[model samples]
Target: MHSINIHNKSGHDQTFEVHGWANNQNITVKAGQTSKIPAPDGSSGAIIALHEGHEGEQVEITKNGYGGNDFFDVSNIVGAGGNITAMQVGDQSTLKGDPHFMQDMNAAWHKASQDTRNKLKGFVFTNGQGKVTRIGPIKDSPELEKLVRTFANGKAYVGVGAWNGNPGNPDDNAQSSAGHGNKDILITYNDGDASPDLASPKRESRVAAFEVQRVQVAAAPPAPPANGPGIILTNKSKQECTYFFYGNYWNGNGTAGANFDKPMKNVTLAAGAKSHIPLPTTFKGRVQRGTELPATWVEFQISASNDGAAHGDISLEQGCDGAATIASTDGTNRKNGFANDVLKDAPAAACAKKPNGTKAIATTVGNWAAGPNQAAIDYLKKVVGQKKAYIVGGTGTDDVASKNKCLAVDMY
Candidate 1:
């Protein structure tokens, strides 16, 4: 159920062998690489042995902690012991013998079976003065050694979540590893001058030959509205246009001076600029450019298809563009300017200026439209990954929303 993330931050390679109560398998992590080991098959827990250095001769573990306990001891049954100089568990609440972790930790030993009671557990890594504390049982008697040998199973797959490099005795890093249960453990080895507590991110040293960390799993949020495909009506003309936008998804403005019928009323679109108008899911609306026109406006609708794909159609007339509408809060005081064709939803795209569409559709269906900036729209037929398709509307235009270089790019 639990897993360990091994960060091989050392210059040399490292091998993590899964053994003990969980599973048995050897994972070799190349320098600069990160990997994971999981306790397979719904098992409660398992012992992870980290074999580091050329000769692999390190050993330092807390020892047999009881049921559901996070603290434990390590031993070297084989001829392997003491080379790795650093170790950390969780957030280091237990390392440096923090009073908090050290307080109730000794109690977990009492919870173990009687034979395991012979062992004593305490801090395994260096303290503030760089004084490395003693590891293993308090008294190394034959009985305790046999008990440790029984647990070691005649092999040392020793493991610690971190390392401080004992290059002379390369075989020592393999002598000790704390057993892990249901929590994710991260192990990053550091050889350079650094703090013994390797918990914080601010002090991470870049001089590692390699490092490994768990690929964190997080719950995903809802799909963003801007991620949904939509339509963009760009304006390249020199005359500023008053754009009125409304639809079934839009709840009309009821403010004192605001229009009561349409959601977007008396919105201004300057000449030579563009605006981003959002189309909601399962949408059906009529796009009218000017207050009056030579012909009727274009009607379009979109519905959610299987997966994240969508299917939509636009009823194009000869002229939906080239028009600017002028009106008041109510549907009165209507005036019109020269408008252009509106009936074509092809693969054509342009960019005058960039536009960033807010992710509003993720919450509710409402009248959403953005503009007064140079923008463009594209079909986004196939995105290699989640990277948005880059749509350039030529020299005079810009589409910021479609050109997100932060997450890689697919030029169109």
Candidate 2:
């Protein structure tokens, strides 16, 4: 039998059905596709039947594949004895009924595929230390270039060692010197993990770097991670926002208690993007909150259209966008007890029980639904779910104040 291969170089996808030849079935090939089909027994060469209907349309076997609207059936007419055999077909439209004509066409398709596979492809750079430095069209980078130069004189194979699909854009339909843009540059090293752990297994023992040899031109390097020393702040709101994280000083010397407060990490969160804002690591530990001046609490000022701040002490101004009440690691019996109070494990220790030491009683003050802090509360919850959050305040008590020190509490 002969060999017929089909490659879809067009931008769109095409489907074909095989009937009366070798197999009877339909296959949809996306743009830049390739497939092969052999001729059936008792058939000289194969017949290429073509029709004008859209792909995947069910057609009669007579006028579909073997007996389509047009037929290029050349059987038992080629190099060997009269045996009805079909070789292969890349494009049935190019089939010729002549003896060697169809066979030559098949050979040409094979050659074209070979040429594509043989081209010098793209490069993927990885450090000898198992770090992927770069991928895609080759570009210059200090770290990657240095690594390449160091390995070039050593065990790294510089030329065509083997043929494989390019990893970066392996299935890209765009025609390139490499078939389907799938060729790889495998850089081996003399050193690597011989035995890796079960949880974190290694792929190859000595593969230090892997570069995909690409026929396409390289583009610019990708942007690096956002620079700074803080929690990455993301803005999912449509409008921009100016945020200020207030220091833990809710019960101290008026607003001046902000002295212990951090230098505001004011960040503008663009809609649908994230930015970084630093928070002191100290905020993760235990905290205390009571009816003292300048209670130790975490606070943040958020200003979008209006400005408001949420504290770890379950306090927020009228404009406070949102809040969340966190229970102590060990829930308490009293609704306002330090264990069961609004403040548990808070970082601040400034506020302490005074004249009415045990006189304080824990009580549930704010309802999330009726309160204005629900938005901020939901946001913190989402961030935590993403594993991007850490607990801040950890201790507090239920103290009834004529005017609540805070209207809402935001976890961030």
| Index of the highest-TM-score prediction | 1
Q: Residue-wise lDDT of candidate 1 within 1-412, one digit each (tens)?
A: 5444556555766665554332455666787676766532223232333433322222222212111122222323222212222233454422221111211222333344755543333323234663332234322344434333333321332222122222212222222222232244554433331123346433232111111111111123323344333444444455765554434321111100111134434345676665545555444334444432211232223322222222111111111232222111111221222233221332223111112211100100001111111112222112110111111110121111111101101000
Tens digits of per-residue lDDT, candidate 2, 49-75, equal 222331211111111110011112222
Clashes of each: 59, 63
- Ten-residue region with minimum lDDT total, candidate 2: 173-182
Q: How close is every model to the real structure, measured as TM-score?
A: 0.24, 0.17
Instruction: Report lDDT per candidate.
Output: 0.29, 0.25
Q: Model 1, stretches more than 4 Å misplaced?
A: 21-23, 40-67, 76-90, 96-182, 188-412
